[model samples]
Target: MYQLYYSPRNASAAVHWLLHDLNVPYELIRVDRKQQQQKSAEYLKLNPSGRIPTLLIDDQPLSETAAILITLCERHPEQAKMPALVSPDRSKFWQWMMYLTNTLQNELMVYFYPHTTDSNGIEAIKQAQVVRLAEILTLIDRELSHHTYLVGDTLTACDFFLFLLGYWCLALPQPLTEYPNLTRFMRLMAKHPSITAVNDIEQFDLDCDIFTFID
Candidate 1:
């Protein structure tokens, strides 16, 4: 059985959702961020970066959400969560996955944790990120307007990654539902059994109409 060290609603949720989608046996070990448990020596040993998720497979630990996600998808190729090596969609998959993790997720981190930057310019940095993030969302929404999924019709781990990012946007001053194409994509993904399971376990109300504005 795989062992996953995670914190609810963290980047780990994407991996958790994939595990459920793959229907694989896995154990969840919560690293309580509230108590700084991720920085504990024991947890750090498994993940030197002291991140929320460190998946243990075959007695080896793996960190980094994107790497972990690709590993899982490759390991369970029968599920086809990652396209085949020679598949035409393969390149597109890599593109969006990197864009989601490197571009979008990083900006979101800055938006949420502005203190990570220069103390005197935290507000300015965060406001700049807001404008940049809006542009990123527009690109994603435009892409979704062309295809049912990020890469194409077939759902991949990239979609799950997108879902995670969209979920994070719930805390933004402007709701994610404002983007119609993104909202449709999110609504479809929100109904998936894997996503539903993860949401229930994490206690996130992402599968409902919570995004609808209260006029």
Candidate 2:
């Protein structure tokens, strides 16, 4: 069984959901972000970066959400959570995965933690980042209008990753629900057995569509 260290609604969420989607046996160890347990020396030993959702595969620690998702998919090819090694969609899979992680995910980090780099003008930084995020969202919304899935017609890890990021966007200025296609995507993904199971465990109110823009 894989061991996953996670905190509720953290970056670990995607990995947590994927583990269930893949129907793999796994153990969840809550890192208690509220109490700063992720930075604890004991936890740091397992993950030097002190991040959550570290998967213990063969008793080896693996970090990064995208890496974990790919590893799990590659390990359980029968589940078909990702593309075949030679499939044409393989490139598209990598493209969306990297865009989600390196581009969209990083933009969110800046929006949420602007003070990390611009303590003097945190709000200003966030205002600028929000514009960039909106552009990213619009691009994704347009893309979704044409493709049933993020990559090909079938469900893949990219969809799961997008769902995780969309969950974060629930608090954005322009609510995720405002994007018709993304809202459609999220609503559809929320009903998946794997997502539903994780929602119940995490106590997330995704089913109720708890998203509203506060002006």
Candidate 3:
């Protein structure tokens, strides 16, 4: 069995969705952000960075959502079947995942938590991140026009990763539904039973209208 430490509506959500998608028995250990439980000594012992979505596989612990998802996919090949070990799409899968995590998510965090990056120029940094976010969204929007999923037709952990990012994009002044291709892809993703289960567990009120806005 796997053990997952999650905080509602955090970066850990992607991992949570993946855990459900895998359909393997896993225990969710909630780290209450309100009480600073993630930073607690016990939690820090699991993750030195004191981050979230730490999965305990066997007796060992795994951190970083991207790495964890890749590991899980490799472990449970019967589930996703997309991130194949030996294929051209395998490389492309890594490409899109890294772009979402390292590029888009990196900028989004800076924007969402500006004080961590620039204490004095918070507003300037945040506004700059907004522009960067839009540009990244456009690239993803275009990619979706070519393929249904990030790498290929079948669903992969990358979809869950992108779903969490796109879901959070709701906080932006511009609605994600504006990106027709991306919204179309998102609508397809929103119907997945694994995602439905995760939202019910986390009580995430993801706006279903985002689905309704498109076809």
Candidate 4:
């Protein structure tokens, strides 16, 4: 069985959703970020970065959402609803996942807590970051216009990553009304039974506290 260490509302949720979709049995180990459980020495031994959503598969620990999702796809190729490692579409899948993780996720973090990095000039940085994030969202909105999922017809890890990013926007101080396609995609993702079932788990909440803007 896979052992997942994560905080609700973190990238861990994406892994949780994927596990549910694959019908894989796993143990959910909650790392209470509010209580600084992620920084505890015991957790650090598992993941020095102290990040949530670390998956322990057969005693091997894996971090990063993209990496974990790819690992899952590799382990359970038969249950793939997403692109497989050897598929021609794998490149596209990797592109979208990295974009969501590196670009969208990073910008959202900066937008939430500008002061965390720029102690003296937070407002200016926040404004600039927000504009850049809005531009990125606009591009994503256009991309979703012609495709139901990020890569192809069936839902993939790419779509789950994008969905998590879009969900963050919903709780942001800024509204997502400007991105119509993104809004539509978010609505569709919410209706998936796998996603709903993950939410039903006692530890998972639809309104995740970790993603809420921290400013």
Error of 3 at 211 (Å): 2.5
Query: Residue 18 error for model 4, in Å?
Result: 0.3
Q: Which digits, one per residue and each the tens of the lDDT, describe model 3 over residues 76-188?
A: 98885456676779888999888888998888888888865556798888788888899999999989889898788878889989988888887887888778888888888
Instruction: List clashing residue pairs in candidate 2.
Output: none
> What is the Cα-based TM-score of model 3?
0.94
Task: Please write out the lDDT profile of model 2 over residues 1-215, one tens digit for every residue.
Answer: 99999887888888888899888799998888889998999999999998777999989999999999999989999998888988999988989999999999999998997765546788888889989999999989988998788986799999989988988887778877668888888877877788788786666676454432222
TM-score of each: 0.94, 0.93, 0.94, 0.89
Q: Considering TM-score, which of the candidate structures 2 and 4 is the better prediction for this target?
A: 2
For candidate 1, the TM-score is 0.94
Query: Please, what are the lDDT tens digits per residue for candidate 4 over residues 16-121?
Result: 8888888999999988888999999999998999888799999889998888998898889898756766788788888888898899998998887676555678
Q: Which candidate leads the pack in lDDT?
A: 1
State the displacement of the C-alpha of residue 173, model 3, in Å, after optimal TM-score superposition.
1.6
**Cα error, candidate 1, residue 145 (Å):** 0.6
Error at 17, model 3, angstroms: 1.7
| Candidate 1 Cα outliers beyond 4 Å, as residue runs | 116-120, 207-215
Give the per-residue Cα lDDT of candidate 3 at 107.
Answer: 80
Q: What would you estimate as the lDDT of candidate 3?
A: 0.84
